[model samples]
Target: MRRLLVLLLALLVATPAAAQVRTGIDVLQQNGFAQLRAVAARHGGKLKLAVLANPISVNREGRRTIDVLRTEGQAAVPGMAVVKLFSGEHGINALTDDMDIDDKVDAASGLAITSLYGRTDAEKRPSAAQLAGLDAVVIDLQDAGVRYWTFQTLTKYFLQACAANGVEVIILDRPNPLGGLAVQGPVSTPGREDYTNAHSEPMRPGMTMGELATMFNAEDRIGAKLTVVRTTGWKRADWYDQTGLLWINPSPNLRSITQATAYAGTALLEGTNVNIKGPGEAPFLRFGAPWIKGTELAAYLNARGIAGVRFLPVTYVPANDKLYPFAGQRVQGVEVLLLDRDRIDAPALGVEAVAALWKLYGATFQIEKVDRLLRNRAVLDQIKAGVDPKRIAAGWQADLNRFKARRARYLLY
Candidate 1:
């Protein structure tokens, strides 16, 4: 018994205790939905709320936020009921890959789900009728910490619509899976904001959704009644993997945290006429096209000795023609292997990849389309002029510094 106790003590000492990080939903539950109840009390004694959520919008125990709000929220706080549901880019279930999602009734909850993503830009925001009788719209979303993910864009539009319609907005914050550090890429150019580039922020702005919401509310001058249920037990520098929370893919393609980290850089290639990954393959882990010479491209990137990643030549034949142009044909590319997440400058590495593609296959590569995601005309011009990628990355420092200073005021954690 004495020997067994000694061995058990040694084992416990050797293993590090898991870090505890509770998201906004978890904190809200712990407080028995007091904040939401207050919002309900503001509007007489009852509140009709609409929830904007996805599969990832769950409490620490893996209960969906919508269900929790409907059941526990109503039970704990009388006169508070979830009347409607909203879905973003991937639909409510986070399974749809189509461009437009139609409204439907959730079988389990029997609530109408209005999709924020639609066939056109105008349909992305809530119609005046949709917000007519709502006391508050509760938003719980998981962001990938990149500019082009579209969830943040949807949130921005939602905020604007709520402000216009005199509806309150409540955001249940989650961690930036990539962590709230290492802001990279260039801020979107003026007069170039779109669904992908919703605001003038870097590709990886290093801010959580709640922080972004606070910034957007103030900076954009949308005076909507806004409340952010701030996440607790999360440090500014801690990545999602360290949070002791389950990993639920924010979108269909982002399968792992490494993929989410790589996405900050690799997604820049998405606008270009290149295959970032094939169907059923890991997204953002590889990039290719029919015309690419895998070994040559890999060699060029490898020679640069980019931080936190290594490149390997690969050949793949995409099975789906629905997405990639080179379906049913052999394609070549490089696989990005993340070595040190803390040390990697993903956006810089992305610039290097684009430059390599430009250098080797400029004729076939539609480099100009990169501006859609890159959002920096000057950087695109530099790439077109064959300027060093390092120089291009260096030019972003002034803008990043300015953004960092502005961003510091809004951080909640």
Candidate 2:
């Protein structure tokens, strides 16, 4: 009987996170959802847990982790406490979905974080007192797979905190919304390694949070005991749209998988005067500024013929009364539409747009601050020298290839 049990256990361990929509959510995969379920079943008797979760951390079956843990009674990490989240400008409500244009602390989640960052009453980092006795922390938040998105930044900080407190971290892996195939732009430099570019990785690391966690643990030598509950069945080339999972907006601006794809580049403009989140609900999918001549700019960009995307003259006012940037100000800029989603090279597109606009508007284009996001100051330098955006993009191919080779070891999907 002992031998039979051991053999059965081996089989169970070998099962993948194979996901299926056996329910409303897609957590039914062999190496994906099943792996998490098995963890609960194995730890059914284990105790003391905290989940660092935002709104989108749910299984493919559409059940949130906290809900599942709650429903699992004592078996699934008994007495698990929910840690509140801190996303700088986005309210706790922006962490989840809602129809309200008010970007206040409105997108409510039942599991709230006491030390949340967005709330005035919340603390900065959870005090050691808050995490004293927790055995492990499960991080299951969704990421856009782009470097600028705050989810990974929050995770890195959380890991550092957990390591300091000697708590283990288990990452319930999710697909990098942009897929795990493309690495764009430059690896972050030392001074630039803050919330925006926390790692020395490229603009789009082409990695899932679990995969990134592995890289983070090794490269940074963070000394945290990290276990990644990895994904199966996902391929490097597959985007979130192909994941067979429902897309949840990790933030108020990133509403769809489409926007997530375009975000790697467009979001680089966050530091600039240009409003990347524009005219309508699809932020980053289109951008405009009041001073931009949309028609002229569109013609310039369309002439470049960057693969898989088209540009159009557009005018928009940041419409959300609460979260809106250029509130009540109408801006004229280009609307980016993807003719072939597969062919869209976001980083390249972003660089080209910036270069063209810089040539036209000079200082008015606001390209100087890109180094904050991409980390390689050389990019801005080259732009200042009138280098072609294509050449600038080509400059990084060698670096991206080296990064890809290095990251291949940590990939789980």
Candidate 3:
């Protein structure tokens, strides 16, 4: 009896908890969850309120069909037993507010309200009260593959809520607009983990949501009942256009694939006095300031001959975007012309841009904001101290190698 009991204890210790309940997870392991057929098998029969985050305006294709709780959902998504959604200070639900240049209010009230995290932006996570007794929560949002974007962090919080509440989460995974390579920038340090810097991945991690889900489940150890509905036929190296999906601006400023690619670097510029011209016609594609001479800036950038990019002098007024501090004021800057996608070292370019901006603007440049985006002040310190972009990039190699190795098992494509 004693010998038999000892063997049982050993076996129990070897197996993971809730292993039996997770058997259904592999239902569509080969085909990406973006395939609607598998989801229809389970969620098709019912139609009810859904507690979804973001808004329906996000999914253009889904808008063709149902309209419930402002979720742009297809027929196959399970009925929301209890509908819920969160809108951060950025007002993820609507376009840039024309009058609110300073983000003083949540102008996105046009969207149906479920749970507004507007003024209380810092705290955004579903409570057990909101998540209990739901069949599952379906999430489908496009990400620029950056840590500070908020969507990735939102996913982490939602996953934690669901894990605690015994609710399942179905992620309709989309492609990372920047492609699934070039995982650059620093890992979030021991502290400063929030909705923005949710995970330990670099500022620009090149992984799809499906891949991220695998990492979150294991690395973060949330243990939520998570299932990723991955896109079919998406290769690991494919960008947004390569996937044959229409480029819906994930946010107001990320207008094109080129802009999105450039964003991997220029997004750090958001914290500065300089206008990246993101709110104007071409965001991330161009940046400027009143103090800058467009021609001079262009010449300097062109001189760098940064791989896979070219610079051209440009001038514009950012008045169209009320949120722009330089709105209605004309400014001179350089437009980033993408020459080749694969060859571009985006973050490296970003470092160089920061260096240039710091060199020119001095006290006027809001250098501290770059730390918020990169999640590591060390990166800002090194760049300000005249560190080369390649050498700075080389610093993260050990961490990147370890992350890549650890993430190998999680990648689907």
Candidate 4:
């Protein structure tokens, strides 16, 4: 009997950690919902938790995450407190089709919703009145891992405010979707510390939002009492497909992974007169302006033979954010194909586009656009002065390398 008991204990100890499961909101529901209940039980069993969210069109599933938390949170705390909804961009309970528009109180959640998207970088800190009576602030948002995505900036703002208000921030993290193997773009320089370009680089230092939160509190010095419940079964090499988490559109325009992949590079075009919108379909990755010559640009990009990508000539006509009318014109452009995403250098792609645009359209192309997107004036100045795009791309490698080493320290997974 003693030997049999010892054998049973050994079998239990030998079993692995449940194959490191990935259950999207289920994992967080287990942690966030149950942990709050546990904490409430300990702290005189009454806690008021404030939930903060980013208003993006792609994440209807987030509504479920919020709903589960609210229900569980109310059960844990009872009548003395209820979960309050605070929206950053779009209101709670709104459809993914809504843009940055805010709606009234969420009818389903029945919680007062507020917007933080209107707050400026200069006034990013949440008002003292907003922080009052909150036991803790819980943040659970999905990120696309692009600097221009804006969700990260909102996270930064909330962190800063929470640190100031003596509020504990619990960040329920998700995957980067783009994976964490490489930080593939321009490094945002010192003077360019605006909200649209918040990170020290245009591309992150190969870190997830949780890692970013740790870095912000540690190296970046936001000084918030931040804790991150990281995802399991995720690694530096695992992109969205590996996690088995459904793609929830964080915004209206971003529909597919291809669109998100193209965004890091093509988003630079936003600073130009290019139209990012399209007709009859979501204009995430499927559209461009008519000003560009597709065939010519395709040939140039092909000759450049950009690593990990192939460009095909295509035409797109968008009705909005364009200088020209939506005439039945065939715009010339290329559909970007990432043959090897690991080797993709997004900032270099931006440089290649700018250089190619300059060659084809000459003075018609806006040279300063890439600079604004990169948040580095030097890149624009170099490309405009007839510097080699490839060589100019090499210039950023040193900075990226240093940032990568620093970023590796904060990684939790």
RMSD of 4: 7.6
Q: What is the TM-score (0 to 1) of candidate 2?
A: 0.82
Over 1-413, each residue of candidate 1 has an lDDT whose tens digit, in order, gives 99999999999999866569888889899998999888988999889999999999999899999999989899998888899999989898877577778999988899999887887888888889989899999999998999888988889998999999888999999989998978988777867888898788998999999999899899989898999998888887889888899998777788899999898998888857788754577789998888899999999999988988999999987767576657677889989999999998888888888899999998889888888788899888998899999888899899999999999999887
Q: Where does candidate 1 stray beyond 4 Å?
A: 1-16
Worst ten-residue run, lDDT, model 4? 54-63
User: lDDT tens digits, residues 280-368, model 2?
Assistant: 54688777777789899999998987999888788767775544456678888887897887777888887887788788888676677
CA shift at 60, candidate 2, in angstroms? 2.5
| Alpha-carbon lDDT of model 2 | 0.68
C-alpha lDDT (0 to 100) for residue 386 of candidate 4: 78
Alpha-carbon lDDT of model 1: 0.88
lDDT (C-alpha) at residue 73 in model 4: 49
Best by TM-score: 1
- TM-scores, in order shown? 0.96, 0.82, 0.78, 0.84
Candidate 3: tens digits of C-alpha lDDT, residues 161-226: 878876677776666777787787667675778656878777777887767877888888899877
Point out where model 2 deviates above 4 Å.
1-46, 76-92, 95-112, 115-124, 320-325
Show how many residue pairs clash in every candidate, following the order shown: 0, 26, 11, 8
**lDDT tens readout by residue for model 4, 1-413:** 99999999999998643223343345655554665655455446676777776543122244465666666646644532545667654344323333344535767667776655554543444666877877677777777778766667777777878888876777777778788786876678875666676667555455667777787677668788776866777777776755656666666567777777777777777656555444443343433456677777788888998888888778765544333334356565677777877778765776787777777776676667656667877777787777888988888888878888888788887
Worst 10 residues of 3 by lDDT: 18-27
